[model samples]
Target: MPLLAGFATSLSLIIAIGAQNAFVLRQGLRREHVLPVVLTCAVSDAVLISGGIAGLGALLTSSPLALSIAKYGGAAFLFTYAVIAARRAVRPGAMSPADHAPAALRSVVLTCLGFTYLNPHVYLDTVVLLGALANQRGTDGRWIYGLGAVAASFAWFFALGFLARKLGPLFARPRAWQFLDAGIALVMTTLAAWMVLPAH
Candidate 1:
């Protein structure tokens, strides 16, 4: 029961639209660096969830300064990415699955890391919220709950990254890519603005 609860809770949290999911979906559609991107996200989630289960969430609670730094830094990175996406939308190009020139492996990996690490919400959800919930499960069940959460992370990322290829036909057109990038830019810009705005 605890395991299932953990799975459901984690899935509910992660399935929400966010920068990480958007990036993964785009890579999956492009058939570019899907494995690395999926693995990076999954593994990063696993680590964060584990840290939460291990009581690192308390540390985060006690350290507002750390979160503040992440907040500003993440917002800046998101804004930069949003601009790049907007530029792509403006100068639209053919991005067929077969025609894309593969981005360098290093560049892809670094971008994946940025998407994973720079998001303050990732820390808040996986570390503070999930950790608090896991601890509520009591000592014996907490680890089980965490395992379920970890499993959910792996399942979500792999399914999103791999299954996204099925949409290849829809995104084959350059105009489709332009529209998609514009949507991505909009999402990223909104998120960045939200991050920097004063908390009430």
Candidate 2:
């Protein structure tokens, strides 16, 4: 029951509309750097979750300077990504299958690394905070809790990617591509703005 509770907690922490999930779903639909992208998302999540259970993630939230740096860096990256997406949206049919280059697999790896590791919220919610809370059940329960957390990472990646792949057919039209690009831009920009906003 405790382990089950831990697992539920893990799912609640991760199953949300965040940068990592957004990137994964988008790439899955676009059939972009999928293997690498999913791997990056899953692996980074695992490492952070493991560290959270180990109680290392809490340290990040305690350091205001480090937290600020991560927030700004994430915001900058999101804004730049948003601009690229907006360009794709405005330039309809500028790319065709022949013109398309392979998706940035290596870059996705790095981007996911940053998105998972450099987000103060990740550390606060997953590692330092979640880990500490999961352990409250007892040493044995902590192990179950950890497993649950890891399971959440795996389930989310596969499920999200699966849904994206299913949507590929529906988005084959040029106009559909534009719509997707524009949506990506809006989501990224909005999230970036939220990150950059000063706390009230």
Candidate 3:
């Protein structure tokens, strides 16, 4: 029950549309560095979930300075990416995956890391919220619950990164790519603004 609960909870949180998911979907569609991107996301989630299970969540929640730094840095990064996506939307060129140049593995990996780590919400969701929930299960149950959460992360990323290829036909048109990039730009910009803006 604990395991299922953890999996359900983690999936509910992660399945939301976000910057990381947008990046992963784009990479998958382009057929560029998909494996590395998904692996990076899954592994990062595992590490974060483990840290949460180890009680790092408490430390993170108590550190206002750390959260502040993450908020600003994440907002900046997201804004920069949003600009890039907006440019792509305005000047759409590649209509198909074959026409797109493959990005460098290192650059893609670094961007994946940024998407995973820089977002303050990632910490709050995985470390603090998930941690508090998992710890509520008894000692052994907590670890079991964490395992389930980690499993969900790996499953979701792999599915998203791999299954995205199935939509190749839909994205074959330049207009489709333009629309997709425009949407990504809008989402990234909104998230960045939300991070920087004060809560009501």
Task: Go through the candidates in order and give each one's C-alpha lDDT.
Answer: 0.91, 0.76, 0.93
- Global Cα RMSD, each model: 1.1, 2.0, 0.9
What's the distance in Å from true for residue 167, model 1?
0.4
Q: Which stretches of candidate 2 lie over 4 Å from their true place?
A: 95-99
Best by lDDT: 3
In candidate 3, how many clashes are counted?
A: 0
Residue pairs clashing in model 2 are 52-127, 58-128
How do all models score by TM-score? 0.97, 0.89, 0.98
**Model 3, C-alpha of 157: deviation from truth (Å):** 0.5
Off by over 4 Å in 3: none
Stretches of candidate 1 above 4 Å error?
97-99
Better of 1 and 2 by lDDT: 1
When sorted by lDDT, best at the front, the candidate numbers are 3, 1, 2
lDDT string for model 1 (41-159, tens) is 99999999999989999998899899998899999999999998898889676545566689987898899899888988999999999999999999999989999998999999999
Measured with C-alpha atoms, the lDDT of residue 127 in candidate 1 is: 95
- Whose TM-score is higher: candidate 2's or candidate 3's? 3
lDDT by residue (tens digit), candidate 2, 87-188: 988987943333477667677678777767656667777787678887686777876788777787778787887678787677766777788778888988
lDDT for position 198 in model 2: 77
